[model samples]
Target: MAKSTRGRVNAQGDGTSGLGMVVRFTPKARSEGVQQLEKGGFRVASSKDFRSAVAVPNDFDGADVQYFERFGIAIVRRDGERLKPMLQNAMQRKVISAARPERSYRALGGPQTMRLDLAQVGGVATSLDRDYLLGYRDAVNELVDRLLGKKGAEGLVARAAFDETSNTWGLQAIRAIEGDLSGAGIKVAVLDTGFDETHQDFVGRSVTKKLFATRSSEGDVHGHGTHCIGTACGPLRPTSGPRYGIAHEAEIYAGKVLGDDGFGTDRSVIAGMEWALDEGCHVISMSLGAATQFGDAPSDDYEQIGQVCLDAGTLVVAAAGNESSRPQQIAPVGSPANASTILGVGAVDRPFVPASFSCGGLNPGQEVDIAAPGVDIFSSLPDDKYDRWDGTSMATPHVAGVAALIAQSDPKFRGWALWARLIQLTKPLSSPARDVGKGLLQARGSGEV
Candidate 1:
């Protein structure tokens, strides 16, 4: 057994209360690791593989279990004093690589204040309010200077800004090179609140639907899912308004992970993701996240699952979050999105300026991977509604839809290869890497994969 490389476990709450933690094991340590932990008296709750599980102690001092497969994370509760040493022992035995306390997650966007056409989801919301956009100007300038030295990089930066003069700015901002490639054969799954099956924009479109929320219906009571779906896979010539969707011909898979109340646990999220992968979705777009503070570690379960998805030719994209105070403070990328194997999308306006609410990243496992238009973006809502909303939530599906287009462009591109194509095709922005990442997403043109 190697010495545990992870730091000492800290008690999250009163030592007497049940606490949840996720233990991530190295690939090589999986089998031996679970065996050793079980032998040490830890109770195995549920697991997707021998590599991970929801473990618990026999009592306040022993282990118990509650397993979550979608996120590949575990939820355990017990006195920290009793739990730490056992986890430390597991680490020392080379059974686990890292461990962290579990917390709740939330949706990144909200209902339009003035909209009359849609219903809103409710929850005990946590606001990620801050102002930090102006402070990073110098860092962005310095990055632009460095980028200018590379061949073609300056041109890329110059082309990053989009024409915001029109109402369909998001479409133009992503540079959707819509030319024959309508994501024809690609399967895209959007895991969120649910879908508005009655939305006219999707009339006659083929869709695969699933409900993961306990006791919840598949129809989208909250409008978030419909709005996101509108951006990623809506009709090319919508009933009204300019063309808003990116992959008009894509096969839509709507998985309702969040309930009508706009809240969900990791269990539901993980279930949705598993369903998406099992259905062979080429791209999975998650516009929701649990808000996190700076330096928070990425989820080990999600990292492993993301890597597996990539290995199987699936690409997962999630919102970087809307917690930035812009120029003053920048929050870390949120869970699922924080996984290095998944693409984390930050928000920029039509002019290629970083959204004041968009999160930035410099942490090892929480870097932002790309940027997309998110502000004042128009898309479909429930009950044949249409409205413009804002959040990194809006930015995520743009990248997902474009990824679908890229995948449709060339059969050879999938998983990490498709991820690389996205970065390579981006028009570099003058913003710092922590803000806008590789730059704004760009779709391939006609006859170009």
Candidate 2:
């Protein structure tokens, strides 16, 4: 943890990462205090109601309050009304913390070679010159690799450990090739843009889905979610490509939190978390993130939500946002993933080197917890198509799927139990813990007794 970023959490959001306010209850509210909730002036939202709580339904004079019983949290919204009185009233008894603005987080990856449009990544600053330089430098490096046998910063080993004849290089690198491919009884929630519910590859698999974001339905138009889902819980043997998925038998719970345009607010993200818990999902995999600045504190609301969710027996795995142009700059891990309890995942390439854009734990307590193959990774996309992409976003699901396998292999793996085992199973790399954390992820092989 860096000294500059240490200290009290910015639970108020600071309106930098997002807009709208999210309220978390104190420990006292855990007793199911109906009176405290009622007096706080909020009604329990229906389990099926995944609407944005910030939209003040019916022109209420003050703030519109909706209490979600599942998480013991409230969302208060006032379109144009005074908020101090209402907030003070709740803060007096029910609200432990309240934050402003709901950040609009985006899908964290795109085309294989540094294709991130820095402008859309909001909050995380990276110059256009840096992006151009990254591309030019990488191009020159590739040219060098071609002219003079494969050699670069990582240097040439006897032979690189990558080939996709039998499976995707990612699966091979992580040793998921021979690992447990069956997560039969485990339920994994992939909370993102949603999955291709009707994609040909998933024909007969049991996939449950819901729309937390206001979209026509839960189908994904942004391809990123489909790619992520395919990695976490796609088919054991795809219709065409080499084996790319893990936990093929794991029941898929697809929650559409980010919409078609690849953007969603904090409200939708939290709603997805609550729904995943309500469905008893064993693992929640999020490949989305809101940008964060150096020394910027993480959301206390998210921190509390993460702790509560973990205690409830579900582990949340999220991407360490691709907000860096390393060597030139390294950014802090983004929100939700930076929420201490959530497993923050970073990206590594074929050489086991950290991806250029992979964010680091520059902020206090925001360290990367794990690493997985994320660069030039092949996986399913929407409409039955497939392609390679890059980002820490790609690494997260690899960890989530593996966690599901661990959960199925042993019934006791949940929350921190699962968290610890995953860390314990990693293969140490040369990279710093700040970049690769515990190290490269290795599946608890199917052959393991």
Candidate 3:
């Protein structure tokens, strides 16, 4: 299975590499902004929820890109000298938040060692194979950069690392206050690869599954979703090993946004989010993200989506990303998770020490909300298997599971109230807020709400 990895950008000028730019219109100006762009001779491809549009500029110099009605954003293709001035003009007029030449996102995951036989799965053909998977990842990265940009997205790539463990330290980390709260009646959604319906661990569990990735099946061949679901809602008494899951009794909504190769575009992810929200899920756990540098802003689309979810009484939690090498290079929180309204989770060890791979909040909107046991954490996988992995991906589900427990503790606590309660009930660590926001997460006891 693929582990969470970072995405890289090639900023070199390559004029003919990609399609035209992507323009994100302001919330209030969405209706009129399209008209304004169209009148200016820009060829609009498609508009997503009136928030963003992909267009080809008719006359780059004569377009007057800065004269839009409201605050908007444009991500143009790398057209050498032609692109730089447009970016400068947009930035100077403040019409767009930021502008940069379009670049491709490359997955850091190394080469594939084996290929799976797709024949057995019927005529299903996905990019799970090594070469096709990389190409698919490239396209997804380009879409993400055009739509969300570097700072606005995370968990789009996966690293080539894995480890095994026998103990479930994540459950023990928050067990002090967990008590008997079993997350009953709460709807927890895990949006990643598909789930393994045939897995013995989840045979009798209540799971609502959906597939959004292209040409992808309804089962988890990538193992990312199954592992995350295991941490969030695995059984209390498993076939082997100690208890690893958090919300043992919570309802599971498994939405397959990422394909079996552990890669997906923003379209699939957004669709999965919409499905989860429509289902009235109390908590949505996204253990995926793209890499982001320090001092990068969050994506406007994701920010708006998160705020909408909050208003609708649902909490979205995402991984802060694993791009930091510590003491040398530290990355900021990744997109979707970087959104101010979204809860960003960082990884920690059983000893309460921040993981070396966990990212920190060096920028304004990239702060980590809380920490959870991610290093060598044991959880369920596909094929009735168990494995341990390390990444902010592993840590995110712990927080989600705890959020389920918290939401179940007090029905009145929803959205912002639930966010506030989780923050208030944490075990404060001595680390800086940039590293661990509030501190390590803790579940509510039987008597406490």
Candidate 4:
């Protein structure tokens, strides 16, 4: 086997002491045997057999197995390994990876579980073949190499943050944040699509939090939020060093407000903000923004809320909407972000060139704060993995994480003091005309800047 890139297992005490076992079933069989196995007192876990097309959570013990004409197979995950010998004898064997890693943080009030991953499921004969299974393993091996490969070839790292030679702007952002204060005791609240809580970069360090803004209590449904979180707080495991997030050791409060479709309501976002504040989070990073503009009354509501945040002393950083230009000229950014007091961020390329997708002066000639590398940034993904994706959404957290670092360096700064310090520390890039407010964000800055 090629060098296995194992995830950092949190092994303080006895590992695998948890009770949960996975079992595979035999290949296509004409008999209603699986049902008989279920009837014999076994619980059904999860099934990803493409042959059978049903994906839902239902209890299946003693009566869970059913044979369908569509695909003649019976597969199930049971509670214990009581029937391991029977299963090994009856079905062709394949490998299994833990579906869910043994999580360190449990829900406020929930059950402890160690879920198993169903890596592959096929005909027992073909699946059991050593070469065939090895071939499948090879594909996975390639994905891991791509995920961690520094040299640009077929890996996600190379795809997102490397050009043939060096790290891209997104990777640079990762470096900046990771450098000075990855260990700051700050929490960056990320509300986006779902994150892969199972990945190695996040291992024992991740702390899941609810986003009251989401319609459902589900975590990031889409992968966007997870990647962004990686930028803000991806844990540094052994194989991956210097790859840690800016606030690498900082606590992450994941709030999956965006659904699988990547669309969320303003109400949901507002709720997420409130939750973050309630938790006493000093810095909240919102890589999301509204595509449409708000009218006077709605705008006023936003300003009022922004002032509330100011009074309560939390920094709400939002993306300047990606939509830009003439016919569809979106005005003065969007709700929440457009609020006079809240910081509205626009994107600039690596060379300080404004991204075409980055919305321009909504409140022209006014202070736009600072700009950082935002085009394509590399960040953490679910599992022991990584990916490079683009969006001002990804960029916002770089600054927010920096805010966490600053707080860690000097804990006295809170509310307006923190916001003022950020603005005061910013190095102005644009002159009177083209670039309005500040240049890029500088971690070590002269208070006079």
Score each candidate by Cα lDDT.
0.73, 0.75, 0.66, 0.50
lDDT value for candidate 1?
0.73
The digit string of per-residue lDDT tens for model 3 on 45-157 reads 33132222121122332433322222233333334355445434443443334323322221111112444455545567643564365356546645654574332101222
lDDT of 1 by residue, 383-412 (tens): 998888889988999998889998998888
- Candidate number achieving the greatest TM-score relative to the actual structure: 2
How many pairs of residues in model 2 come into backbone collision? Answer: 7
Candidate 4 lDDT, 1-449, residue by residue in tens? 01111221112221254312222222334343455455558533222221132212122223333222222223333333444444443443222111111111101000112223345656332224433443455456446645655332111232222231233354453235234455357767876665677666666775756643223435444567777777666654424534535667787777655555575543345445655666677777777765433322123334545667778877777776566652355344544455566776666544344555665554533234666556546566555555555556656776776677777776676777887777766555532222324556655542111
Q: What is the C-alpha RMSD of each candidate to the true structure, in Å?
A: 8.7, 7.2, 13.7, 22.6
Clashing pairs in 3: 152-335, 153-335, 154-289, 154-290, 155-289, 155-290, 156-289
Q: Which structure is stronger by lDDT: 1 or 2?
A: 2
Ranking by lDDT: 2, 1, 3, 4
> Which residue ranges in model 2 land beyond 4 Å of their true spot?
1-19, 29-63, 92-95, 113-161, 215-217, 445-449
Q: Alpha carbon lDDT of residue 214, candidate 1?
A: 47
lDDT winner between candidates 1 and 4: 1
- Ranking the candidates on TM-score from highest down gives 2, 1, 3, 4
